[model samples]
Target: MQSNHTEKMSSLGLSAWYGEKQALVNVSISMKANSVTAIIGPSGCGKSTYIRCLNRMHELVPKATVTGQVLLDKEDIYGPGVDPVMIRRRVGMVFQKPNPFPTMSIYDNVAAGLKLTGMRRGKSLDDIVKSSLEQAGLWDEVKYDLKKPGTSVSGGQQQRLCIARAIALQPEVILMDEPCSALDPVATAKIEGLMASLKEKYTVVVVTHNMQQASRVADFTAFLYLGKLIEYDETTKIFENPKEDLTERYITGKFG
Candidate 1:
């Protein structure tokens, strides 16, 4: 579905392509402003690819290419003079696994994104670092040891640190690719709660292998199969009364 560019944070259309092989096929969806949208599907279904395409990341691969428009606030991200770095700054990403900068302290890790955008040496930087960590819900745990290496934190803390890093730049949209897949149950729960709170301020697009996680945190859910979006609807409707039989079967623990 083509999005109303005027008000949408992100939108995609008939967007598909490949290295001489088509992966996504005319997939279209509009991400709402300041809401959580979860993409769920079996492996190799192009869930990850779809997210990457949002910031013009798919073309980063040597042999990959895509056609169709992906807009951010009505401006085509691929338009001439649009820098990928600038696009990414507006659209932050958190990977499946926690990836903290090993050499940096927790404070520095959170401030890393700001440094990339050229914010350095001031109260502004310090305030952003602290506030970002607080927003990620990690400040209470690590505030005392801001100097500690990020790798010294536990798995869950490390993930939150990564989130803090993303938020420091104040991106309008945050893309999370299976962010909780690496954490234990308790850690996963914390991240889900964080997601819930984050939507109040930032638009979040998440990809998840865990169906329950999708059900728990998503305001909207989109199901994909073979790179095609099969169903996109309110999370409750999609979970409780999916329009597509494939979605129902998958949610019921049948073959993914």
Candidate 2:
């Protein structure tokens, strides 16, 4: 069961399609403000597509289309007259791979986001970049090396750098799609640690295949299967005592 805390975002009858194939169906769940919500299930269960819809990124695909309501602060993001770019600004994303601008320097990579959003180069920009890097726990390691290429860092550092770029936007919500899928245990741990700290200011929704990671970081967990929501409850309840048989089976390694 979910508490009565404020919801930062919620979906109503949300569904998505790629050409003729339906990807999701009537999926509705509330993401609480300043909290971590983990979406877990087997591969191809619409985890990525569902989060993308939250930020209105699903429409970026060639044949993608979505229906229903994606409310941010109760405002319909996909409704008429709403701008998708603005929606992205309010909801930043970090993908599975640490894709920092391969050619840009670390400082430039973080600054790019601010500049694109019309924030100019100055003390303010510098402070935000530094603070975001610090917030992502990458400052000490790369502060002096700001001139180096973003890709010059280790896989873990690159991922954190990407996170810094996202946090630089100061988005209200952060959406991550299997952020640690490609990282080593140490790097994964660092990112996991970062997630816990981030919810202090932003709502976080992550899709992960690693059930243990979800159990460790998420306050609430939503289990999905075959494009349907099977169970959504506090993380402990989902793991320790899930109500749905499918959720229990998947969590216990009976099947993914």
Candidate 3:
């Protein structure tokens, strides 16, 4: 909103319920294309649930239901005849834990999604895999030994491998849930730096517990508390001069 950026995804009065219990309130946020938007909030505030709804991952849970609409490129993802598999391919996800297929090699780990999407194996797949690893900043480290187990690499490299796997799909958007929470500071920094470059072409939405991380890499940040969206604005404004008292208090470390 600050820079006249085009919106890539948006939610209109979105709410979620797991069986009888509600997890997210009516949440609406327009995410900028080719920009990083960080979702920050305390635990149990529905940070994870909100992003899960983006690609319809939330519905995978039993008795899950959603109200309102999630739009990707102005198309309602939850509308009738919409394919969840197609939406997943268009909007990828990287979990908090680096979940490279343990049984697969580095090459296969990146190739798994492609194969599932009916991408025939050939030079095109090979080229895309190579390009994706390069984009994720992990090719150089593992290029020589792509045959090695994906988890054989260090924690950070494994995380980058997962990022590469997501990138291989050439998704327009990538949702990361605390992607660096398991890594040390050095590894965390690498992931953070990667996100900065990633926003050049992919609309990224990350849910992070580290407030400093949200402040550092996000173009815009949304603060949710107890399932309610307290404030949404440019990162600088949210951190420096939030309009809401709740936002100010949270940013100041008074309460989170």
User: How do the residues 83-157 of candidate 1 rate in per-residue lDDT, one tens digit apiece?
Assistant: 988899889899998999999999989988877679554568888888899999999999999999999999999
How far in Å is the alpha carbon of 109 misplaced in model 3? 0.2
TM-score of every prediction relative to native: 0.93, 0.96, 0.96
Model 2 clash pairs are none
lDDT of 1: 0.87
lDDT of every model, 2 decimals: 0.87, 0.93, 0.93
1 or 3: which has the higher TM-score?
Answer: 3
Q: Cα miss at 205, model 1 (Å)?
A: 0.5
Model 1, poorest ten-residue lDDT window?
1-10
Can you write out model 3's per-residue Cα lDDT over 1-256, one digit (the tens) per residue?
Answer: 2243999999999999999999999999999998999999889889999999999999999999999999999999999999999999999999999999999999999999998788654568879889999999998988999999998999999999999999998899999999999999999999999999998889999999899999999999999998889899999999999999998988788983
TM-score of 2: 0.96
Q: Quick one: RMSD of model 3?
A: 2.0
